[model samples]
Target: MIYISDKAKQKVDALRAEGTLASDYFLRVSVVGGGCSGLSYKLDFDNETKPKDQVFEDKGIKVVTDLKSFLYLCNTTLEFSEGINGKGFYFNNPNAARTCACGDSFAV
Candidate 1:
C-alpha cells in the first residue's frame, strides 16, 4: 500500500481547484532506469488506469501505479516539503536499496 501525507493531499487538491489537473486524475508513481543511482522516480498526475494498475487511496486522494512499478514502490510514502530552498513533493520509498545524491533517484 502507498501512503499520502496530508500536505501532499492538500497540494493535489489545490492544483485540481486551479484547473491544473482533471477531476478524475490521480497521482502516478513509478520507478525507471537511468538515474545517477541507476534508478529514477517518476511522478505525475494521470487519468488513465492500466489493466495491471494498483490503486491506493489515502485521505480521499487516489494514487495509482502499474504492476511492475508497484513492486518497486510498495509501502512508499508521498510527502511535501516547503523551505527557503524550494517547495516540492518528496517520496520515501522503503523498497529503495540505494538513493542518488540528489535524492531524486534510487536503486533496488
Candidate 2:
C-alpha cells in the first residue's frame, strides 16, 4: 500500500483547484529508467485505469501505478515538502537501497 502524507494531499487538492488537475484524474506514480541511481520516480495525473494498474486511496486521494512499478513502490510514502530544501513531491521508499542526492532516483 502507498501512503500519502497530509501535505501531499493538500498540495494535490490545491493543484486541482488551480486547474492543474481534473477531478476525474488520479495521481499516477511510476518508476522509469534513466536517473543518477538508475531508476527514476515519476508522477502524473491520469484518468485512464489500465488493467494492470494498481489503485490505492489515502485521505480521499486516489493513487494509481502499474503492476511493474508497484514492485518497487510497495509501502512507499508520498510526501510534499516546502521547507528549507525546496518545494516538491518526494517519495520515501523503504525498498530503495540507495537514492540519489536529489532524492528523485533510487537503486534497489
Candidate 3:
C-alpha cells in the first residue's frame, strides 16, 4: 500500500478545495518510462478507474495506481515539501534503487 504523508494530505486538500476538479476526483499516480532515471512518476486528479487499478486511502485522500505501477510503487509514501531548498510532492519509496536529483523519477 502507498501512504500519504501529513503534508501531502494538506496539499491535496488545498488543491481540491480550489474548485478546479470534480467533487469525486481522486489522485492518480503512475510510473511511466523516460526520464533521467528509467521511470518517471506521473500524478493527476482523476475520477475514473481502469480494469487493473489498485486503490488506497489515507488521511481522507484516495490514491489510485495501475497494476504495473503498483509493482514499482508498493510501500511508498507520498510527501510534500515547501522549504526554500525545494517545494513539491515526492515519494519515499523503499523499492527504488536510485532516484533522480529532481526526485520525480526513479529506478529499481
lDDT of each: 0.88, 0.95, 0.91
Candidate 1: Cα lDDT at 101? 71
Candidate 2, residue 5: how far the Cα is off, in Å? 0.3
Q: Which runs in model 3 stand beyond 4 Å of their true positions?
A: none
lDDT of 2 by residue, 4-40 (tens): 9999999999999999888999999999998999999
Looking at candidate 1, the ten consecutive residues that score lowest on lDDT are 81-90
Candidate 2: stretches off by over 4 Å: none
> What RMSD does model 2 have?
1.0
lDDT score for candidate 2 against the true structure: 0.95
lDDT of 1 by residue, 40-101 (tens): 88899899998888999999999999898888888999988777864499888899888877
Give TM per candidate: 0.93, 0.95, 0.94
Inter-residue clash pairs, candidate 1: none
Rank candidates, lDDT, best first.
2, 3, 1
What are the RMSD figures for all models against the true structure?
A: 1.2, 1.0, 1.1
How well is each residue in 1-108 modelled by candidate 3, as lDDT tens digits?
989999999888898789777679999999999889899988888999998899999988899999999999999999999879755998899999998888888999
Name the candidate that leads on lDDT. Answer: 2
Residue pair clashes in candidate 2? none
